[model samples]
Target: MTFTGRPIRIAGASGSASDRRHAIAEFARHYPTDPVDVIIADFMSEFNMATFAGRRMDQAGNAMPAYDLSFLEALEPALGDIAKHGIKVAVNAGVCDTKGLFDVVSRMVQAKGLDLKVAYVTGDEVLPAIQNALSGGQSDFRNIYTGEKLADWDFEPIYAQCYLGGLGIAAALAEGADIVLCGRVSDASPVIGAAYWYHGWQRSDLDKLANAFVAGHLIECSNYVCGGNYTGFKSLEHGGDGWANIGYPIAEISAEGDVVITKQAHSTGGAVTVDTCTSQLLYEIQGPWYYNSDVTAIIDGIHFEQRGVNRVAVRGVRSGPPPPTTKVGITARGGFQAEAWWFLTGLDIEDKARMLEAQIRRLLAPSAEQFTSLKFDLLGSNLPDAKTQNRATVPLRIVAQARDEEALGPRKFVKPISDNIMQGYPGATFHLDMRQGFPRAVFEYYVTLLPQSSVQHQVHLPWKPTARTQVIDISPPPQTKTYPSRQPSQAATHTDQAVDLAKDFGPTIRGPLGWIVHGRSGDKGADANCGLWVRHRDEYLWLRGLLSIDTAHKLLGDDALQQPQLAIERFELPGLQAVHFLFRNLLDRGVGVTTTVDFLGKNVAEYLRSRHVDLPVRFLNRGKL
Candidate 1:
């Protein structure tokens, strides 16, 4: 088929529902004409959804059920503008209740006296399916990390949400939905759904859908593709302006499966370049194959070129069939935790921490069993003849966890620390956050896949059947059929030939990797991936060798490298001159349960960037210092 169709401009307004008000207002200011066919707002993430589910459970009998007002608060002010411009909005801002949010929107818009078609895509809630599986021995539900059964847990489940695709959203838009509210679809699905509807593409049109899928990924995180979170962010125009006026991203997707990612025209402070787009594309991706509920996008075939000022054309796109299963996010109350911190100054920081832990151990001797976990981390250095106060003082952070509130509560956990006030180390003091010392609920997420056949999807056309509520049937796409994994130029096999250092480059200097390389990394549940790229093609060879598995293991430091569960896998994108590394179980029980300092794992790239490495002297002489 010849590629002939209108290009759809999809703009992402909000990264999360909490920032919708600002996102909407900023978009309204920047986009005076409101130049977009569909506005996508991503309001929910794995953390936020779990948080909402926990809140709803807590507010079971409250006078008014708990619903996040941030989304509506943001949308209320922009309703007039949206209705005036006739721009359709797709958002996953509904949290756990799309119906309730839509109901609120229905009333708000009606009061404003605007003619709009408000619809909601529902049926992502999979609690009943989980219950059914649990009732039948729970063998069906397995943890995505460890292949253990969910039935093994003794506690009850808080929430279970399955990831849905863009079909239902397309159906809603087909019926002329002015506002499409959704609970928990893929973050990129809103863009995907909008593109699908705009192009009137078929389910079997893999190439078109693949392009849309990649395009959605580009604009999914508003400012990331527009230089906000990019590693080489300083290269963008006004890169120092900060995020105060950071612009949202816009994707110009053509019918021929070509995408040019850009920012709002005349928007303040950002640039869409090949580097920025590449950075965003590598963010949060597991492998070359970027999988979604609707389709498994083959990102390995990606090709990019700067088409114009502030525009990057991404082409050579392809796709694989959608995965046979959809991932279901399962969350439950893990336990309660209480923590206290003490500062040690002048000297003997580690010594002071050890003494405090010993004192606490003696104090809790009677009820030691009451605590399931007690950890003390001595933060900062106790350098001899310290040059600054910051280096001389260290803080001791002690945390304790238990199965319930009573045992690991503030009264019980804090009493031991407080009792040793006089007997503790000299010049030791504590700055306490009253809430942190108190027992607080901790959530654990169990991510796993479920067959698409079990999902119940419906599109609620609120204006259908006499401007009344109407639910239309929407089915899942056919099972994904496997295809040959795309391997680009950089996939050349490793050569065993000895490196001729003199032939490659004359000499070398040691410096931070960030000087010659850029990187982006993120987490998916317990797993993490980071992509490192070099600007010059000649630098790619050196980087590939520098970041090999053995070198990476050494670079991760002794603690992370020696962990038994740590497994590393590398995929090379030769076309882009980048190496993507997958680190397993790096974030403990994911961000929600991890006790690590880098909880979300957003800083992995920065951590690697900080590592000092050798660079070619000649290359350094040619590039800016």
Candidate 2:
């Protein structure tokens, strides 16, 4: 079967099973009535093994695919429909050794004698390779697991693949594979791959592929790019349709691989503009190098031109050198940790933070034996020297780590915070919420070279085993859990948490306080009292805020509350009275709003005045405006 349309678009499903199924169904409903060409499902994460194994075993008995096989299994039910329309399905599931995966695919294709071609893309694990490059053979880097040098083994990897680019997928498609499987490829690989295959671009066609990859990246996270995380974006004026059912992003790729990232034409949300597209481009793309199944593109020149409201044309990107080595995963025993948090509310946010810090330090003084390490973070209004003229809530998070299991157990280190809630600070209230502790495993990694000839690609057909048949499972590596080293103490009780002042204000307001308000608007509309602020220029800017239990409950409730407006109002302090009024209103707003306050101030007076109506307001003049 061959693709006959403009290009095959593969949409990513949410990590959740239900969400993925819904996404697939939605894709099917919107696309051609008949199967277009290929439908690929990607289910990647450490926790998916159990889910995949359980589902497959229930369906096909004990003969189960590898742990990474969930990607394929998810689309198995759709196979008949896809095949009926002469389309194929591809999936990236399970963890297998990289070399092993390539070998398995190569062997399968040759044995089956099917008219299929295969290729392997690499470069996901670059940390080890970077380490190897930085260290010149003298001092080998120790695995986080074994604590031993990594050069003791004879393992070689073909593809030092990072989150890959579209080139490899294009290579596979060009080679004429009915199906393609990849490891550690970028979320946009399939989409970019389809574009390259359709355009028949070469590996050196960096400009075209990079443009296509950017478009793919914009829509890769499914919801985030399509206004899910867009700041200042309000609901549609007509109905709740915009927020209720957000449309997924789509890309229109030309024959030259120039891409336009947009949403369905009839969708309720607005189009993708330069601002929206730039925001998506910067999302989660750590540093300069962006990797895919093949090729590393240097995001040096990201130029965006608005074609339409929801359509953006991205161009001018460069390519980089592939890493010389591959990353190896190694797991070993670590230690354990436990943590607890409390809420502090009322007008004395700065004093509350100081008292809590002293109290926690005193608590640790008596029996520091129980914990190897201790940390404290003043969340919300409890932050040091926060300014507000209202009742603010501060949250205190305390974390403790121990070498032995017994010392780190929940009852030993975690229970003390809960036990001393009423004893520590007068207004301190401790909730029953305690973070559970678990064993930590450290994985040490190394980078080594493998001749390109060692890596092979093949396709496997499902059939009954022959007398000489030997079945080998091909899946990605298992994910390991790491333990936290230092956990902080709770800064405040639930009642004293801070609110975000910037987000609560109107767009017309401008000041340091307005800056604070704007900052909180992006931080999930947390209470102003439950946040921290820093004074710069003539304005008091809200830096960060912590979530309060009550506020969390309300925001996450079934009924939709106007959180965005609240954020706007809190941050938009019109004047001294507005600041005072906002703070006083926080107290009247009850535990829900007051429980999320946190602050950071230059001194105690500034902090107190920001939260007290009766206090004298002394505005700081820092030259210029």
**What is the Cα-based TM-score of model 1?**
0.91
Model 2 quality (TM-score): 0.56
The segments of candidate 1 whose C-alpha lies over 4 angstroms from its true place after superposition are: 1-5, 17-20, 29-34, 63-67, 133-139, 236-244, 345-348, 364-368, 379-394, 466-469, 482-493, 496-503, 622-625
Instruction: Quickly count the clashes in candidate 2.
Output: 124
* TM-score (all chains, Cα) for each model: 0.91, 0.56
- Name the best candidate (by lDDT): 1
How far residue 322's Cα lies from its native spot in candidate 2, in Å, is 4.2
lDDT of predicted model 2: 0.43
Error of 2 at 571 (Å): 29
